[model samples]
Target: MGMKVRGISYYDYMLLLFVGGVIVLSFPANLLRVWGVPFFRGPYYDVIFVIFVVLALCNLWMSKDSPLPSYYFAATLLLFSTMVFAIGVIRGNENVIAGMKYFALPLIVYMLLVGRRFVLSFYSSNFLWSLVVGSHVFCLLFYYAFLYGRVYPGIGVPSISFAALFFLAKQKYFLLSVSLLVVLLEGKRSLLLALLITMVFMRMVRLSVVGRLIYTILGIGILVLSMYLGLSFLAGITGSAIVNRINLLNPFSGSFDILLGSSGRAGELLSYFRGKDTLELLIGSGSGFTYEWQLGYASTQEGEIKGYFHMTPANYLAAGGLLGLVPFVWMMLLPFRAGALKESNDTRTVAFGLGVFCVVQSFFGFNLATDAVSIIFIIGPMMLLSEQRRPGGATALRSNSLERTS
Candidate 1:
């Protein structure tokens, strides 16, 4: 029995190891919270979502010889929303309009890869990795230095994440390193800590001797650099200060318990978005909410709150209203696309890597909710698990030959 376990193929084990990547990556993403009505909000939330959707679709067409529905994951999410709407209806959340809005085009389709052809397709694999790395870098750069005269870098559509996704794909250590440092120096204490835990855990579990050596050197280098930056760039912050800031999100006894347990922001959102004098608030305002709800479009009021959102659920509410939100509740319950990857070498590794990244990033961000971004984040993995697949091979199940777009 022990020998049998050992005999599991590297690809299969790789598939399993993929989960580690997902856990490490997802903590920084955003939300899809549903209350009396469905609403969402955040900084750069839409940018992340759009990017996720686009990658998912690209992955769908990229997937080879698979009969998966490509749309099953998204459809399932939409269907789940319907069920949740039933609950809202019963409770008379008066948010049925909010719940039902998600059905418009509530389907996600993933790419299907054929055989081991893509297993070692270095170009494609590295391309995707580059996208991840570049996005990470761009985001960090945006957070720290700003870009193209924009206060927020990735906020621009023809911006960093987009530029890197298809064009400049590969593992960019420079960008990655910069991100690590920036997150540390900036006050995003939660993100830095989460990433540290994730990196250490991965090293402990699967990093090879060479990888570990490289990583140890890398870690020491980063710490030393951070110390320099702390003294030069961020004079006020200390190691203890960094640790304390990160602790706010830790769920620890002293610092964590009373966490967002500090409800000023939460209370404000409820009052501003969910309070009584709503015109179409129940059904939701429109198909995308930003800062300004009294006025259409994603803008916010002038002053301190400008460019920021008070109501968190504004994204969903804006896109579909309760009328559309109903079709997406419990949407994530579907196994991540990795669970549906076929038993093969190249497909398994690529699927696992992509799936894990999407899951981790989406959880921490919210790119999973955008149409373009959701392509890779939510549906790309599903491409491997669509209804096109069955007990037998997809070739055997083909009725009409169709070239699905990658």
Candidate 2:
């Protein structure tokens, strides 16, 4: 299965698939509708999901052993997630399938990646670097398109920027600068704060003194250059008023309001918590059952659009209750635990940082629950899981030995 095409290995192909799929799939479906394009219409909406699933199943079938941790925490998390899915099926929540497409698909893809018997070791510099470059290019496209009006990217911008930064920091500073510009342009205060958190974390754990100093200068340069670039386009495209709308000082305040807002799950969570019995608080309404489809007030060319509040944790808690929520939170931590088992400190830190970034981003957007951003979530942690296996672990040991001698 690890055959080469010309010179490129099957491992490289899968890496490409993971990176490319995330970028292409992140394009707003609403953009296609706005243009009335028949592209990717109908049953093809899940194309990205299908690609990952097929690849995952192939890898899983061929895999000699499981990549899953045998720890009690890992067991507890998986069991809870399974119970949530089963309850959703029992409750006849049609959207459970959609949730599977988003959530479960990534989980499968991640396991396949971390396992042996398919693809290269995740520790391969080639694989890691390619992912970094690919993500940086996507971030460039995201901002450049927004600047020139080719697409309307939204909410998850800061998370995407920082994720790229995690990879870029060790490789290329220029790409990181460009990505920082994109995050600035996209203008989500919550995500911006998340980016800051990631940067601070990286500075504390990952970077050497020289690396930190370089980044500090690069960050200042990026800020100055981005301002010039943005101001030049202020009147025509980069809309300065949008920046005014950003309450940078009050980033988390809005999240609190959303929790208290009538339009969202805040009230529902309260009612469910105050239930007459304890089991009701324990089980939740069932997966994908909390939110209902409703008409949106914003009228598009297709008429009044319809959707639901997908504020992930709240919705998941409302649906799966604590039964679903606890496991979901644990699953988020599993990557870090897996990474902790890796001997390479840098690799472990990067994997854990990626996990932190994803978890933080989830609060403002459903990036972890959506196919596009799930790619980011899946690749980083699974790469760490790959480290615990054979050839990959061997390579890491060699590198560690060389470093000790040096």
RMSD (Å) per prediction: 13.5, 8.2
Candidate 2 lDDT for residue 140 = 53
Mind giving the per-residue lDDT tens digits that candidate 2 earns over 1-406? 1212233345545655565444433434433433345764543456655666676678656654654533454455456557667887887876776655544544664544544312222322333334444554565565456543443333333334544545554555665575566566555555665675555554333456677588767766776576556544442432343443342222332322443222333433343344336665568655555432222222221222222234457645655667667645754554444344444565455555555666766665556556444444435454544454556574543332211111
Q: Please name the candidate that would achieve the greatest TM-score relative to the true structure.
A: 2
Number of the predicted model whose lDDT against the real structure is largest: 2
TM-score of each: 0.41, 0.64
Residue 250 CA displacement from its true place in model 2, Å: 3.5
lDDT (tens digit, per residue) of candidate 1 on 1-406:
0111222334323432342233223222311111111333443444433443454355455553544453454455545455445544554554455324322223432221211122222213333344444555544454445323332112222112221221212345565554455445444432333344334322221345677588868776876666455434443334574555444344432455231432223333443464434545555433322232243222342222222232223344443456444433333433234444444333333334333333333333434433333323334444434433555534321321111233
lDDT of 1: 0.37
Off by over 4 Å in 1: 1-124, 127-268, 272-330, 343-366, 387-406
